[model samples]
Target: MSSDTSKFGEYGGQYVPEALMPAIEELDDAYRRYVLENEDGFVDEFRERLRDFGGRPTPLQRADRLSERYDTDLFLKREDLLHGGAHKLNNALGQVLLAKYMGKERIVAETGAGQHGTATAMAAAHLDVPCEIYMGERDINRQRPNVFRMRLNGAAVNPVTTGRGTLKEAISETMRDWATTVETTHYVIGSVVGPHPFPTMVREFQSVISEEARRQFDDQVGGLPDSVVACAGGGSNTMGAFSRFVSDESVDLYAVEAGGSSLAVDEEEGVAPNSASLSTGTEGVLHGARTKLLQDRDGQIVESHSVSSGLDYAGVGPELAYLVDEGRVTPVTVDDDAALEGFHRLSQTEGIIPALETAHAVAWLEQATSEQLGDSVVVCVSGRGDKDLESVIEETASREIPNAPDMDVFSGGMR
Candidate 1:
């Protein structure tokens, strides 16, 4: 698609520096040919690799305990079961493969929770390509396990210390790296938030979640679900879960965002206590796209906070902003405490440990009204909680998380 057609209404556009135009243009062409048109059996190969390597068709199982609690038929789209233990692999593998086909010899990317970094590293290793990942220093410390996983998979993990040491800075640093090394490197953006082909391309790659869930729901549940909910940070999995259901007017799509501590913004301090951009953000340009952002009155980007490092972002994906504007998707929020409760609740009841990011969606289910959910709902379990164990323990201990397990035994720390 052309730059104009790339947009979801006016929420998307190429707003990058002039130096990155050639790389963006080239990637757009490759996206059209390989991804859109499936040139050289690319789509076929991608699917084959996904099945044999990355593990396609993750289960869409009914959450019996959660359903009983919510008084609705609740199903979980178990993306956590996929290789790399999250939905990140779907896009990472696809982008890395695309880069290989485009004859790029190196891969670069940004990560917040480290799921994407780990996934990218695994894909690059499998494809025999050199890879590097830029991560915020704070996130690197919080997500040390994932950092180790990436290095184990043979990718360099570069820490970005600028700004709040979070997703925004990592993305900015990656863009700078890509701008300088555009000819030899492909920047595998982890989410559907960047310029032109990236938002569209990442969504298409990750849409397998809903594609399979939709089919499986029909087969198992006998009809369409009443609502489809997923956590929205930069909106890869959000768009993925909602894309296939967008045309289905009967299906309600809910994008649950992080409501860190409060929705209030300290404009003078340039900090927002939440990442609920979809719910409260105004329009602005950020990270090469025009979308909803947590910007001050003077248009300065504000810092965003979230207990889950993955969900802390100043802006959301352009398409998600457009969809919310069009009223096709409803934007919602769940506070950090509720999310922590959800993290423990699911683990106790459903025998599944969800990532703190996924916990946001789970928490919303508890807060949502019966009328909002209808009779059947599907929540995307975006990732497993293995990466968030340390953060969860610390946060759970700091607050009185109702569903949290006994912590007195490990009061010192998990050795």
Candidate 2:
């Protein structure tokens, strides 16, 4: 896709009113100039900050036990080691710096899992900019740890009660806030699924993952990875890890989506839910751009449930939809049980507990091995599992176990 027409694949043109176009155009122009001229320095500065401030080049460890269990080569890109514990900091650092360069006073963002909110708060604190994070009431409750982290970082967290009180509702609130205060407040979108300059801009900032992964894999294994996999909520981490390999058609790109319960047999129906939008969704306009959405015939967005809070979104980014359509990317869905299982498996085997969101990618290893994927598969472990301990324990306690024949038999006693 050329730069001029890259705004929308087939579905994502500027559908906003005339007033908003100029603002969007201005952002696009400024971003284009920044990318063309100053990106080299911006990237270098960001890397230094990530190394000294945020921690860069997190180890790409080979998952020996996981590889043996799955019978395939599996390597983990340890993004969970980054400061703030996810890929959110990459974009937050870039955008916050850009906001500083533009002389913006306040920064505002919307977050679902609160990872992005916390990261943004950290950046704003570093830059001494006023920051506000809008989150849905439900999400705030579910992701309280991150909310508190953001508050400790000095960001005021506002709860959105309108609509479904989820990420979508939070997005609506953020958009309204941005429209009213666009001049002094820079809205930092958390993912790659937003407006034009946003999708492109966020992707550029996140491309650092693939850039480093390319060199790291070469140093470790002496060549590019055979496959690169990441969980896709709005696809920031996935896009980041896949950007440098975009032109490398020979390298495989796998995007894992939340597939709840459908993977386990003997489990009751609906025990797990599936939120695979690209596989089961249709083209539609959602959250400012045209993309694949899990919606009904009447155009109302359907309620999407996933074990991963981050991947619970109803719509995906335009570029991903384009890639899926062109067969450049493969989309797979894993159930909640599988993801939870994969989480425990990785934790026990590799001593690396991954976020529930990132576990969806690990779960894909099961399917990938079954399909005979090659020896080297790199999975993006986007965040640590610290946030999911409670849920994991709760789910484990709820499982059913069969009764043993007799305890006396094990004790060598007569019954």
* For every candidate, C-alpha RMSD to the true structure in Å: 1.7, 5.4
Q: Which stretch of 10 consecutive residues in model 2 shows the poorest summed lDDT?
A: 263-272
**Tens-digit lDDT track of model 1 for 15-97:** 99898988999999999899989999899999999999988889999999999999999999999999999999999999999
- The clash count for each model shown is 0, 8
lDDT of 2 by residue, 1-415 (tens): 2244645459556555454566567667666655545754755666677788888878888889987887777788889999999998999988887777667788999998888899999999987899999999988888889988999999999999986577777877888887777777788888887778777788888888898888888998888777899998788998998889988887889989887654221222222145677767789888778888777666777666776778877778788888889888888888777787778777777888889999889877877753535777888999998877766666655652122112244468567
Best by TM-score: 1
lDDT of 2 at 88: 89
TM-score against truth, every candidate: 0.98, 0.90
Best by lDDT: 1
Evaluate model 1: give its TM-score.
Answer: 0.98
lDDT of each: 0.94, 0.79
The lowest-lDDT stretch of 10 consecutive residues in candidate 1 is 1-10
